[model samples]
Target: MNDWISHFTSLTAAPDNEKALFNKARPVQWGSDQIIFHAGTPCNQYLLVLEGQIRVQQISAGGREIVLYRIGPGESCILTTACLFSHRPYPAMGITETAVKAISLPKSVFDQLIGQSGLFREFVFNAYGNRLTDLLTLVEEVVFTRLDIRLARKLLDLGKHAQIIQITHQTLATELGSAREVISRALKEFALRGWIRRGSGQIEIIQRQGLQQLANSEFVSSR
Candidate 1:
């Protein structure tokens, strides 16, 4: 079983019960920024992340990329679950944000495990539920929230542990599902208000309180 229990502590199956699953799932690895799955591709395996991060994102018809969610250690890709259950091609792309290591169960074994193992069913369904909630929350934010408020909140969240955010305007645009020009203008406004300072490929937080105030405000920025 390769002692997968050590990495995936959230999987609560008894050792003997889990052995069948772990034995069937072969280990896989990917380098950082590698595309693991392309949009519209059929999935033949289900993966459980053992280390590093995988970013699942969707690109609009206009070619704007927005992150759907990230799967980290001990987490599984809900998209993979959806694909396996519905027997459809991937609706979005998956890329490894960091060098990743995971255990991959073939589609046949995955299907069998879901039917034959109660513990496996729980693990898969629970992950699906949680990721679905995240997607819903993201949709709500995009539709109901202002872009400027969301941008301010993103800055505050990113700088929670540091004053400097090591990112670019285009990257922030991608993160917020907006355009680079739009994000650049908003950041310029923030800079004008003395809330932040834009540097080469980075932004320094000058006034966290100011950003906090804006993040809590209801005034919508014209994006």
Candidate 2:
């Protein structure tokens, strides 16, 4: 129990105070490609990732599964936060990329813990703030960054963990808020530069540092 409390406490600031409230935590298992929960489903519980990857995605009006973000181990689902305060259905779907282990707590318990513990509240507050900052950064990228530059940055970011970094053109398009053809062309440009090697269902990052340099050139130039 001390180790478990210490793990979460390291993620934030206060551990001893929030430890008791998590005594009733329940474990949930999700298989690969399984939907942990669907968009618009009633939110009664929240989950904290213990293993594997979970993606938060929403379908656009045009029927694209736009990825909001990827949550790895040590991150909690945003749907959990939404459920704690509101009765509405979750706004996005959580899909497991690999077999996943998570801890689920009733919405009421989650709220009570946060409300009674300053350290727990601070952690959730910081998590929410980080999410907002990420969203704003994505919005700014869409509004002001060139499509090619954005694509390059995304490639660099995703390549950090992926061994083969496989993603379809349609998926890339959805993630970038652009058409498939546009994403394809940008990828082709990267291929031409020897920065990546394109495949039918994937693009292998060949020159990660070069791609990163290209992504950061604007900042470098400003400096």
Candidate 3:
């Protein structure tokens, strides 16, 4: 009884419908870093996350990975929804970022709900559209934005609350679609500027305002 209905803002399930859905869904748990889906594999079921985070990412043939987005509590993966509708293999990989609890709905039940419930349909489509927009934004940043600015923004985002981030350079590189050498070089520049201090798998934001300026420096000449 995960109360799946509350996750969708557009849908309010009737008592009977709610019970049916709850009974039909299979509860699943994934530990941190577990692969939920692999690229080129067909998705067997749609997932509704009840707890924790799932990271969706794409890997290039050269082994470079770029994170597309994350699905958290009360969220579902739009890519899996597309796979279910199109009857195709997943185009990217999904992994658990933390220990996750979810409910898996078989294709038949999911399709039935989509066909019978207008609110569910709306919710699904809206979620798909929002994720599509995020992918597009990521593409724009990767193609048009400078790496330094993107890295700065990413650091500010991660260290926003605690002013310290516990992550490896390679991990940060993966998130920004850059190489480890590039991230290391950029971090060195930030260090020289007295904005941040880097340690083993950690970064401390010493001058938050200065880092913010670097992160927001859109007009800086890109080399």
Most TM-score-accurate candidate: 1
TM-score order of candidates, top first: 1, 3, 2
- For candidate 2, give the lDDT of residue 214: 79
Candidate 1 lDDT over 101-202, as tens digits, reads: 999999998988888777778888998999999999898788778988999999999999999999999889888988999899999999999999999999
Clash pairs for candidate 2: none
lDDT of 3 by residue, 1-223 (tens): 6366566544555447644764687889999999999899888798988899999988889888888899998788989999999999999999999999888989988888788766667777888899899989998888878888888899889987887899999999889887888899999999999999999999999988887886777654354
How high is each candidate's TM-score? 0.94, 0.80, 0.91
lDDT of 2 by residue, 113-220 (tens): 878877667777777778778878777777777878778888888788884687898989878878898899888888888899999898899888778887986632
Overall lDDT per candidate, in order of appearance:
0.89, 0.77, 0.85
The residue ranges of model 1 lying beyond 4 angstroms of the native Cα positions read 10-12, 15-18, 218-223
What does candidate 3 score on TM?
0.91
lDDT of 2: 0.77
Model 1 worst lDDT run, 10 consecutive residues: 9-18
